[model samples]
Target chain A: MNRTTTEKVVKSLKQRHRKEKLFKAAGFASVCFGFLLVLTLISDIVIKATPAFHQHWLKLEIDYQQEWLGVDSLDYEKLESADYRKVLRRSILAMMPEVSGRQDKRSLYKLVSNNAEFTVRDALLKSPEFIGKKKNVWVMLDDDVDSYLKENTEFSQTGIRISEKQAGWIEQWYNNGLIDKQWNTEFLTSGDSREPELAGVRGALTGTMWTMLVTLILSFPLGVAAALYLEEFAPSNRFTDFIEVNINNLAAVPSIVFGLLGLAVIINLFGMPRSTPLVGGVVLTLMTLPTIIIASRASIKAVPPSIREAALGLGASKMQVAFGHVLPLAMPGIITGTIIGMAQALGETAPLLMIGMVAFIVDVPMGVTDASTVMPVQIYLWADSPERAFLAKTSAAILVLLTFLMMMNTLAATLRRKFEKRF
Target chain B: MKKLPIILSLIATSSNLMAAGRDTISVVGSSTVYPFSTVVAERFGKTTDFKTPKIESTGTGGGMKLFCAGAGIDTPDMSNASRRIKKSELEMCEKNGVKEVTEVLVGYDGIVIANSKATKQMEITRKEIFLALAKQVPATDGSEKLVDNPYKTWNEINPDLPKTKIEVLGPPPTSGTRDAFAELVLEGGCEQFAWIKAIKKQDKNKYKAICHSVREDHVYIEAGENDNLIVQKLTTNPKALGVFGFSFLDQNSDTLQGSIVDGEKPTFEGIADGSYPVSRPLYFYVKNAHVGKVPGIKEFLEEFTSEASMGEEGYLTDKGLIPLGEAKLKKIRDQVLSFTPLKL
Candidate 1:
C-alpha cells in the first residue's frame, strides 16, 4: 500500500511542477512574440523609409542660351515669358541627350527634369537679361523622378517616386547620360513644406542650429552663474532651498505647458513673432535652464573641496580659487551638462509649434530673429502631410535628426570621457 | 473573469451588430464640418433611432485617404472637405469601389486674413501678401532669396494699402485652413500673374513650388490650427496678421479685425457677391450607406438642407460662419436631400 501510494503521489507532484514550467515557457514565448512584432514593424518602417533620404539626379547637358548667359539688370523686367522658357527649355534639353528627331522629344524633355517650372522661372527671374543668352546649366530634376531613381519609393511615376514610365525613360536617359543618382542634401537640409519633392530641412536645421546657439549662449552662462551662487555662495537656507524646489518643479513642468508659458510671456509680453527662432530659443532656454542649472550645480559640487582649499592656501581669494581651480575641474561637467541641455532643446517641438515655428520657411534662418523651422517641426510637418511620399520623407528626416542628436550625445560622452579624469 | 468573458462576448456581439441594416455611417474629414454634423446628428438621433454616426476631423486629405480606402470596415461613409477634392483623390475613391459619392457644398466660409486690432488698418494685395508670406517665389532675377519686395510691400503689391509688415500667422500644413489658403490665396494669387500662371500650367510642380514658397525666413509663419493662439498673438503683436477662416474673424471681431485684401473686406455679403475674393465653400459629405442603420445621419443630412440649419442666422452661421448665398445654399441642400445610392 505504501509503495503504490508513494509512487502515485510522486507522479502527481511531478505533473504539477511540469505544468508550472509550461506556463513559464508560454509566458516567455508570448514576450518573444511581442518583441518580434515590434522588431518586424520597425525594420519595415526603416526599410521602406530609408529610400527617402536618397534622391536621383537628372543630368541635363543643355547649352545655356547665349542670350540669357550672364543676366543684366537692364533686361530684367523686359524678359519675356518665351525668352525665359526658351532658356529653360534649352537647358532642360541640354540636360537630356539630344535625339536625332522628334521621336525623342517627349521622353527627352521628360529626362531633362527638375520639371518644376518655378526653379526654371526662378532661374530666369535671377537672370532676366539672360533670356536671350544661353549656356549649359545643370538643374535638379523633378522630385518624382529624382525620388524614384533614388529608390525612396517602389519606383512610382510621381510625387518624389519617379513614375514607372519615367523610370523606363530614365533608364535609357541614364544610359545616354541624362538623369543620374546624386546625393540628396535637400532631404537632409531643407525645411518641411507642402511640396514633398522640394521639401528640405535647411530652414529648420539652421533655425534649430541658431536656436541652440542662442540657448547655449543664454542658458550656459546663466545656469553656471546660478549654480555657483547656489552651490558655492548661497548659504543652505530657506530662500535657497525654495529656489531649488522651484527649479526642480520647472524641470518637471510639461513641455507644452512651457509652450503656453512662451506664448503668454515671450511672444505675448515681449511681442515676439510666433516663428522667430529667437522666441523658440528663448522658450527652450527657459525650459532647459533648470536642466542646465541642475547639471551645473551638480558639476560644481563634484569638484573636490580640497582643490578650493589648496588654491586658498596659496593666498588666493575665494573668488579666484572658485573661478580658477574649481571652475576648470568643473569644465567637463559643465560642458557635458550644457550639451545635454542643448540636446534636449534640439528635439523640442511643442514650444516651437505654439510660437509658430510649424510654418513653412524656405531659406535657412540667418539669425535668431528670422522666421524659422526646426528639425523636429520639420519632422512633425512631414509626418502630418497627406502625401504618402511625406511619410518616407518624414522617416528620412527622422534619421537625420536622430543622427544630429546622436552626434551631440557622442560629443558629450567623448568630452566626459576625455576630460573627466584630466581635471 | 466571468464578467470579463461576458464583456468580451458583448463587444464581439456589438462588432457583429456593426453590420446593421445597411445603416451604419462614418463621415471622416474636415473639422470645419464637424459642428454642423454634430447638431444634425442630434436632431436626427431624436428622430430615426438608427445607428449613431461617427465623424472624424482628419483634415480634407486625411479624410479622403479613409474615404478612398473603399468599401467595408475600412471604408468611410462620406468625406467632408473644405476644398474641392483632387482628381487623384477622386480617382482613388473610384478605384476603391466607391464609384458614386454625393459631393455637397453646404455653406460658405470666406477665408479671412485677420489680424490683432493693431493690424486692422493694414490692407494688402494678393501679390504683396503672397510675397511676404509665401515659402518662396519665382525671383525676377532667378536667385531664390527671401522676397525683398514682394509686390514691393502693401502699396507696391497693390496701390491702396497701409505700410505694415507682412508677418502672417497661419495654420500648419495639417489643417483645412492650409488647404483653403493654398487654393484660395497662394494658388489664386499665383494665377493673377500671367507668367506664373503659365508656369503653373506648364509644369504643376513649378506652380506648386512657387505656391509652396511664399518666402522662407522673412515671410509666413506656420502656425498650427489653434486659431485662439493666432488670435492671442495677433492681439499682442499688432504687426502680425492671422490667416484663418471667417469663423475665426467672426468670433474674434471684438478684439481683431478682418484683413482687407485688394481693398475688399471679407464679409458675408462681400463673399456672396464675389467682392471678397478669398471666399471659399464649406462642405459636409454624408455616409449614404449609413442612412438607414444610422438613425441620425440621414435625418441629420436632411436637416442640414432645411432652412433651420442654414438660414442667415442659423446655428451654423452663428458659429462664426459666413453663410453662402441663398440660392447656392438651397441648391446644395436640395442636392443632399435628393441624393440616392445607385443600385450595384
Candidate 2:
C-alpha cells in the first residue's frame, strides 16, 4: 500500500509539472503575439510611407517665351492670365514631335503635372530675368509617371492613366538619365491640396502646435490647482468625495461625449468660432483635465509624510508646507503625467471633428482662432481622399504623428527615472 | 466675493463682442458639397469685403437636422446637400418656425465605379453590379425566390468577364454618394427584373430589402467616408474597385479609370447631359430669415450664382462640377438672387 501511494504521488507531481510548462508557454505566446502585432504595424506604415518621401522629376528645356506668356515685364495681372500651359505643351511636344493628333498630344502632357505651369510662373515671379530665357529645368513629374518609375506599377497595365505612347516616351526619358529622383521637401513645406502632389502637412502641423500649446497652457495650471486644493486643503466630506468620484468617472467617459459637450456648451452657448484651434483646444482641455487631475493627485499623494512634518516643525504655515515642499517633490510626476495626457490629446480625432476642426483649410494657422486641422484630422482627411498618392502621404503623416507620441512618452519616462524620489 | 462682479461683467462683455460682429456667414452640410462651397467662399472672401463663410461638413441628415432646428443669427445661414430636402425635414422646419427656405441647385456630381490604372477597365452592366453586390439576389434559374449571394468571382456572374475576384470598396450608408448610387444604379437595375418590379407593387418594404441591401461578405468592403483609402487599396490589390465622386476620378485620371456602366462611359460630357447612369444634383438651402440680418449672406449667394462661377466654362466646372443646362441654370440663379421661398 505504501509503495502504491508513493507511485501515485510521483505521477501527480509529473502531471503538475507538465501543466506548469503548458501555462508558461501560453503566456509567453500571447506576449510575443502582442510584440509581433506592433512590429507588423510599424513595418507596414514605414514601407508604404517611404515612397512618398522621394519624388520623380523630368528635366526639360522650358522656353519662357514672351509671346506665349504675353508679358515682357513683371505684370502680376497679365502673368496670371498668360497661357503658360501652352508653353508647357510646346516643350513636351518638342521632345516627341513624332506623336501627333489631339488625343496623343493630350496624353503626352500627362508626363508633367497640371500644376507644372504654375511652377514656371512662380519661377518667373521670383526672378524676372528668367522670363525671356530658355532654361533646362527639372520639373515635377505627374503622379502616374512617378508610380510607373517606382516599379510597383507598369506602363502596359490595363486602365493605365497614361497612354501607351506617353508611357513609351517616359520610359525613353528615364533610360536616358533625364528623369531624376529627388527628396520631396515640398511635402513638408506646402499646405493641403486636392492634388496629392501639392498636398503638404504644414497647415496641419501648425494647427497641432497651436492647439497643443493652448491645451497645455489651460489644462496644466487649472488641473494642478484643483489637485492641490483637493489633496491638501479641501475637507474630507461627502462633497469632496463626490467630486473625486466624478473626476475619475470623467476620465473614463468616451471622448465623443466631450465633443457633444463642446458643441453644445462652448460653440452653441458661447458662440465661439467653429473649426478653430481655440475651440479645439478648449474641447481637448476638458477631455484631458480628468487625466491631469488624477495624475496630479497620485503624484501629490506619493510625497512623503515626513517632509510635511519637517516643514511644519520648522514653523512653516500649512500652505507653505504644501506648496514649497510637497509640490516641488511631486513636480516630476506631475509633468510626466501631463506629457502623457498631451500625447493622448494629440491622437484624438472624433472630438475635434464634432466641433468643426475637420474643415479643409489650405493656409497655415496664424493664431488660435484660424480655421485649421490637427495631425490626426489631417490624416483623416487624406485617408478620405480618392487619390492613390494620398495613401502614401497618409501613411507618412501617421509616421510623423507616431514619432511625436513616442518622443513625448520617452521624455516622460526619462524624467520619472531621473527625478522620481523614493523617500 | 470681490471677483463676482468682475466675472459677471467679463461674461457680459464677451457676449457683447460676439453680438457685435455677425459679419461671417455660417454654412454647413454634406462633405460632397463642402469642397465646392469652400472654393467659392475663399474667392468671395478674397475678392469682396467679407469674412470667409464658416462651412462645416455635417453629413446630409445631420445638416438638415441643424438647419431645421430654427431660424436665428446663431443658426447656420445655409445648408449644402447632395440630396433634395426630405418631406419630413420640410415639415420639421415649418414646425420650428422656419417658414421660408430657398433651395439653390448648384450642379451635378457623377458617381463612378473606378479601379486602379493597373487593373483592366471593367465593362459592367448595372445588372451585374446589382447581382454581385446585393445581399440577396434572385435565383439565377429564373425562380422568384431570393437567396444569399453565392457569386464570388466576376467570371461566375458572366463568362465574358475576367476570372479575377469581385471585390468592391464603397462608402457606408451615411454617405450621400452611397444614397445616390443606391437610388440611381441599384434601383435602376432592380427594375429590370419584371417579377421584382411586380413585387414592388405588392410589398414596398420587401422590395426595398431585396433591392437596397448590400452583401455583408468580404467581397464588398464598407470603407467609411474616406474614398482615398479605397483608391489606395485598389492600387495595392489590383483586383478591387471603388465608388467615389467624379472629381476624384478627374484628379487622379493618371492612376485610375472609371468603369463603363450600361454601355455608357462616366465622362464629363456624359454626366453633364445625363447620359451617365449614376449622377445626382447638389444643392444648398438658405434660411430666408438670416438673409438680410447676416452681413455677407446676399453677396455670397450672388457670388455663387453668378455666371462666372456656375457657367459652362466657369471655375466650378474646372473643379469637376458638371454644369447644368443653360435653362435650368438660369432658373435656379434667378430663384436664389430673388430669395424666392421654395414651395413645399
Candidate 3:
C-alpha cells in the first residue's frame, strides 16, 4: 500500500476514537444530571419532614381544684361534663402572674394546645385521686410554639403567629428546661383535625387501605377472567380485535374522566352514597381494569404454545390445560400487574375528588361505606392549609406515602424473583 | 382469593346499612366558609354525643346542586355559601322536594389585597385599583372613551402610590373570591367615573363587561385556589401583591399585611361592621325535612348558633370569622331556632 493511503487510515482511526469518547461522556453526564435532580428532591423533602418527627411538650403544674371544675365529687357523669378548660387556663395563668390584661391572659393561654384540657381530663379520669391535688403534668405545645421552637434562631424568628411575648415565654421555658422534645406518636394514631398539631394520617391510611382492598378484590378477578378468555378462548374475529383496541385506548384515557363517570353513573344514577371508599374503589377499578387486563394478556401470551400442544397430545382437555398449566405459569406476572395497579390506585386523588372524597373527615373510617379521604387528598388539603405548621406535616406525609409505595414495589420485585421461571 | 366472597358480602352489608340512613349530619359548601364550619363541627363533636359532621368543600354552586337534589338521606343536610342563595337557586330547590330550608347567617369574611411585610403597606383606593387592573381603562384624554389599559405601574395610575410594576397574584375565575373581588372592588372603582356610572342603567351587561374583565397581560397572574402558594410567592417577590380571604392574613399576619382600601383597614371589627367594603356575609342553609330525620341536626345547630361559637368573642373569631352584632345575632338565633323557611 502507498504511504498516503496509510496516513489517511490512521487519521480516520483517531477521529473515530474521539467520537466514541465524546458519546460516552455525554451519556454519563445525562445520567448524573438525572441522579442529581432526584437526590435534591428527596433531600429537600427529608429535611423539611425532620421537624415533624418530634414535637415540644410543656410541663405544667395543674391544681385540679374541685371548685374550679364545679363538681362536688369525682363522679363519672360530673367528670365527663366538667369544665376542665377553666382549670387548665387557671394553671397556665399561674405560670405568668405578671400578665393581668385580658388580651395578655388570652395570649398566654394560647401557648398550650386547645386540646390540653382533654388531656387533663383524661389524666384525672384515669386517676381520680388527682382531682384535688397539684400534680406536674406534661401537655402538648401549640402548633405555633412547636414550629417556633424548632425553627427560631437568633438571626431569624419567622414564626408568623408567635407574638413577642409568646417568644419570650418560649425562651424562658427553654432556659428553665421545662420543654420536652419527644417522639410524636399522636401524629400516627389520631384522625384529621382543624388544628395542625392534632392532625394525623391514620384516617387517610385506613381509607387508602379500604379503597385499595376493594380495588384489588374487584379488579383482579375481573381482569384475569377477561385476559384468560381473550388470550386462550376468544377466536380472532373483528369483535375481539375491536375490544382489544378499545382496551388499549381505555388504558390511555385520563383518570379524571373516570371520576366524572363515577359521579354521573355510580352516585347520581344508581343512588350510591358519596365520599365512601366503595365509590372510590369502584371508580379506580374502572381505571386499572384496562391496565391489568393488558398486562395479564401479555404474560399469558408469553406461555409457550408447545406446552399446550404437548398437553393436548396427552389427551388433556383445553380448559384443563389453560387453567391448570397456563394460568399457574402466568400467576407471577398477573400478581405483579395487580400490585402495580394497586400502587397506582393508592396514589390517585383526582378521580376520588369527583366522588366527594375531597373532604375534611375527622373520623377514621370503619367500613367501605363510610365517608373518608385518602392519603393524596389529605396531602393536598394540608398543603393548601393556611397554618404554617401544616407545611412540615405535608412534607412528612409525602415521605410516608413514598415509603408506602416503595414497600409495595419491593413486594412486587420479591414475588417476581421468587416465583419467575426463565424458560 | 378465597376470602374475596367474604369481602364482597361485607361491602354489600355495609352499603345496606348506609341505605337504612346516615346517622351523622353531612355538610357541604364553599371553601371560603370551610375553615369556620370545620372548627364548629369539631367542637360540636368533642363536646357532644353526636358524630363529627363530615364536610365537603365542593364550592357554593356544587353544594347547592347536592343540597337541593332532594330532601332525603342520600342528599346533604346543609349547604354553606359565602353569598346569599340566588332566586334561580330557590326555584330549583322548589322544583325538587327541598321545599323548606332554614338560612342561618353564620358570620362575615373579608377579601384582602395583601403584600409581604418587607415592603411598606399600601393604601390603595378602589378607583386606583380599577385603573391599574381593568382590561379597558378610561382614556387619559378628557373624552369619555375606553382603551386597553395603558398604565404600566402603580405610580402611573396615582402619583402618591409606590413606583412598582402592577403585578398582582390572585385566584382564577372559578374561585368565589374572584367573583366577590370583581363585584366589590372592581365595580366599586368603576362607579367613580360619571359616564361609566350612567352606562350601568342603560346597559348593565356592558357595564359588567367593562368592570369585571381584568387585564390579560402578565401583570395579573392566576395562581389557582391555593392561598398558601400566593403567600409564599409574595414573600419571595416583595413588590407583588396577592388577593385572598382574610383568614390567611390572620394566620400569617407577621409576614403579610393587608392593604387599606377606602379608608378602612381589613380588620375583624371593620369587616364585622359595614366599614370594610370587600366583606361578604357567610350563610348556611339547612333542609328542614332532615332536621328530625338526622340524629343530631338540631343539637348541631344549637352548638353552631350558641354564644360560644358565633358570638363576637367566640372561638370562631380566632379563626378570622367576623361575628354579627349583638342585636342581629340574637335575631338570627331566634329565626334559626324556629326553622323559618327563607321568604325568598
User: Which is the leading candidate under TM-score?
Assistant: 3
Candidate 2 or 3, higher DockQ? 3
The C-alpha interface RMSD of every prediction is 23.1, 5.2, 1.2
- In model 2, pairs of residues that clash are A384-B226, A385-B228
The lDDT values for all models are 0.66, 0.84, 0.90
What residue runs in model 1 are displaced by over 4 Å at the alpha carbon?
A: A1-49, A59-139, A147-177, A188-193, A413-423, B1-344
- Scored by TM against the true chain B, the candidates give 0.83, 0.95, 0.98
Q: Quickly count the clashes in candidate 1.
A: 65
- Evaluating just chain A, the predictions reach TM-scores of 0.73, 0.91, 0.94
Model 2 docking category:
acceptable
Specify the poorest-scoring 10-residue window by lDDT in model 2 chain A: A151-160
Q: Who is ahead in DockQ, 1 or 2?
A: 2
Residue pair clashes in candidate 3: none
Candidate DockQ values, in order, are 0.02, 0.27, 0.82
Model 2, residue A23: displacement in angstroms?
7.6
Candidate 3's iRMSD: 1.2
TM-score of model 1 (CA atoms): 0.48
User: Model 1, B1-344: lDDT tens per residue?
Assistant: 34645544653464354334334345667766655554454434333445444444456776787677666543556777887777787777778777766777777777888866754466667766666566655565654433444543555444556665557788887888787788778777767667777776589987787775556564578777656567667888887777876765664565778877888988768886778888777765554544454345546676677775676656466445666667777877777777753222
